[model samples]
Target: MAKEKIVLAYSGGLDTSVILKWLKETYDAEIIAFTADIGQKDELDGLEEKALATGASKIYIDDLRAEFAKDFINPMFQAAALYEGQYLLGTSIARPLIAKRMVEIARAEGATAIAHGATGKGNDQVRFELTAAALAPEISVIAPWRLEEFREQFPGRAEMIAYAEKHNIPVTASAAKPYSTDRNLLHISFESGMLEDPWFDPSATSNKDMFVLSVDPEDAPDQAEYIELEFAAGDCVAINGTQLSPLEVMETLNELGGKHGIGRVDMVENRFVGMKSRGVYETPGGTILFTAHRKMESLTMDRDVMHLRDSLISKYASLVYNGFWFAPERLAIQALVSESQKNVSGTVRLKLYKGNVIGAGVKSPVSLYNPDIATMEADPTKAYDQGDATGFIRLNALRLKVGSGVEQNAKK
Candidate 1:
């Protein structure tokens, strides 16, 4: 008799590696390990050999970088999605894509169940399972972190290490570093461990060494660098006169922004799982793109439309943060966001200096700023009538005047 087949979302990290071996033992099933290459740099190195050695019957490594940048990151950026006005939703945004691909692989492989390494306490579990429920429905999800038996067996990283040694599973992770990290093309995030205390700053040498995307702002170069970004329909098309693919553009900006120590954020954020967590993020390329995109929109977007889209920013951001990427409301909101970007084509010059992305200049072919109307110097043709101001001011101030009069009457 053949055993049930299970597809596992495997990272070469300690948690997933242990889960790979444990799942096989627990289920006595055929396991297929899946890894999504969404620009985790060299972290994908030797992942296949590791998974195979750890008892995975087969391994699937899909290069999803282009799809991630074009389909996921671009749309989120178009909506200017930021959770709680601080976090750029880096880790939050990546989960749906990872799960989506995992589901696809599971379906193709005829696997009856899918498993992931996301813990019970974090948002990724919800993300992975929610996506599976939405997409695959009939597929069972195997989340070992939520199992009391599994938790008792592993307890912590130390026990997991011991198990790995006993099983002869190859792993390089140590319990010395108390914090956890997640990285991809868009950003790198650090949390848990010493970061759990709100007052604990990770500027110490040991903690600083954990940063993969950027350096300390104080250690950045003394000189500032300026670059221009070109956008077409709210998507960045060119950088500094060079036309590159989506991922290439991101990589270029990451290099430039990291060098100047741009895009470092530290905050205590509300998780979808009903908890507050402190996270430190370095989003060098994403920060540059966000800054440049906003400047470009200001140049070309209409005032009323811009305000309407701005009203949706929080809601759109929340949808992304809460793992609603495939939800109907998010799709509706994305349509509007896409509509607003029809004319968001322009060039924005930005100055990167010591962690700051400052807009130097913005220009668009369809710019709303009319020099003739805006100039302090009077135009010979008199396009603006100065006499219109008296009526405009009185009409606008009428409600204020009426309220003040009513208050005075009440006092009397």
Candidate 2:
């Protein structure tokens, strides 16, 4: 009989590299490594050679950057999905797409099982398994971090490093700096190791070199820069008068935002697994896009419609953060969000200055703003009748007046 085949989500990192060899040894199966290229830049270099040398029978280096931006990042941004009102769900959003592709590769390769290197205590495990469950329930998911034998054999990074050395696996992790990172088109996140401490200051003098996307605000250029973003159906279509594809948009904004020291966030977030984890993230392009999109909405979207969608932001954000990107509820919310964006087409001018994305101006062909009614100096056109305020205020105040009268009567 042919040996059982397993597809592993390989990153060429310490954990995945070691896991690749371990899976081949422990299961005695043919290991097929799959690496998704979602804009990790130079990290993809020499990955194929390393995986092959590390004992992968076959390797798939798929480029999914455009798909990642258009399918995953764009829809998530349309809902303005910010987890806990802070996290941009950078790492959270990428997992489902990665897992979705992993399942596809498994099906094409006739693999019986898929494995990931996500730790047992982290959110990626949930994201990966839940996605697999949603997309391909029949395929077995081998999570080594959750297995007693695997965890016991390598309880710490040192053991994994030693094992990698012994097996001739190429890995970048070392004992001196073992912090974990997840990078993709939207952003790059750093956590674990030294970042585990909730109070650890990532901006301290000792950690000056930690940031990868944006410079420290204090180290940014003294002069501020301005740019304009044009949107159509809620997706950014152009930046500074130049049309760009979704992938180009991200690449350009990352460079611009990084130069201005924008989009650096350090927060302790509650993971889906019910644990609070400290993370530092650099989401330069996402920050710019989010700010510009909101400004565009203010100009075009209806007030009630915007407010209703705003109320669903938390729920939608939770759905994405909790690894339910393919769930029914998230799709329903996406429908509503997509409907809201039909009128969210516009242009927003912004000032980028030292970690701040400040709106300068916004306009849309379908803008609802009417200067005739909104102007305070005079309304010669009489668009908003001054006399209408009396009844409007009295009607709104009736409940307040009734409650006050009841309290007064009780006091008497």
Candidate 3:
């Protein structure tokens, strides 16, 4: 009799490694491990051997770093995507791309099912499942965390540790830290365990050890570094005088920003599963990009257009966080986003210093900022319409003025 094969989205993490061995034992499936190298630096180290040691028949490590930066990160950067108005959606944006690739591999390998380490309660499950549904709905999903046997057999990380010990499966993780973290070049996020406390200040002495990509602000370089970003339709194409690919741009910014301790954010954000989760994120490239893009928008994008997009920004972030990447709604919004970016071409200078990214300057060939129209010392008669603003203000204030008079009259 032949064994059924399942493609697992493996990360060589404790959860996935344990799940890999457990699947081979329980389902008798030839487990094929798949890891996506989405800018996690050295995260893929020794993963192949580790998977094979833990009972995976084979391993696939797909280098999706370029694709992630170009397709996912760049588009989201154009949108200036921030989930819950603070988070840059670093981890949120990476999952869909990886899952798409996983499904593609599943089809190529003739796997009966796709498995993942994502727990039933997290956004990752939604991310993986949605991508699979959108790309390959026929393939079955085997989530060990949701499985009755797996959950019952190992109720927590302790049980999984014991199981790994019993099987002599080599694992480096222990139960010392109850938290979980996810990282990529753009950002590193720390959550779970101690972070579950809403009142906990993540920057406190007890918690200062949480960050990964940065040094302490006090220890950051005293001097500020300024870099100019060139954007073509809201996509960063160059830094200073050097042209860059999407991945090149991020890595450069990450290196520059990390050196200055630039991108560190900690906040309790609304999760897609109707919960407020506290996550500390360090998105150095994203910090510089957002600062530069917003500055450039002042010189290029229309005020009305910027406001319209701003109004829908939260909705866009929510959709991305909730795994609606393939929905028509996201497509409709993204089309408008693309249209808005048509003239978002410019150069923005940013000053990075000790976790602060400030806009130094902005220049654009298509700048809406005309000195002739806006200069304070301009001749009082030409290139402007001050008299027209009287009527514009009157009409705009009609409702407010009338409401105020009505209240006064009633009081009188």
TM-score of every model versus the real structure: 0.96, 0.97, 0.95
Candidate 2 residue spans exceeding 4 A from truth: 410-412
The better-scoring model by lDDT among 1 and 2 is: 2
Which prediction has the highest TM-score against the true structure? 2
lDDT of 1 at 204: 71
The Cα error of candidate 3 at residue 223, in Å, is 1.3
The local distance difference test score of each candidate is 0.90, 0.92, 0.86
lDDT of 2 by residue, 123-207 (tens): 8899999899999999999999999999999988889999988887887767777487778889999988888877888998778
Off by over 4 Å in 3: 205-208, 379-381, 401-412
Pairs that clash in candidate 3: none
Model 1: clashing residue pairs? Answer: none
lDDT per residue for candidate 1 within 92-174, as digits (tens), equals 88889999998898899899999999888888898888888888899999999999999999998899999988988888978
lDDT, residue 157, candidate 3: 83
What tens-digit string does per-residue lDDT give for candidate 3 at 1-412?
Answer: 7799899998887888899999898898899999999888788889989999999999999888899898888777777778877989888888888888888888898887899998877888898888788889899999888889888998888888988888878778787875778998679998899888877777776766777787667668998888899999999999987999999999999888888888888898877777777888888888898888888888999999999988878888887888877778887988888899999998988888888988788899999988867877755548677788899999999999999999999998
User: What is the Cα-based TM-score of model 3?
Assistant: 0.95
Estimate the overall C-alpha local distance difference test score of candidate 1: 0.90
lDDT of 3: 0.86
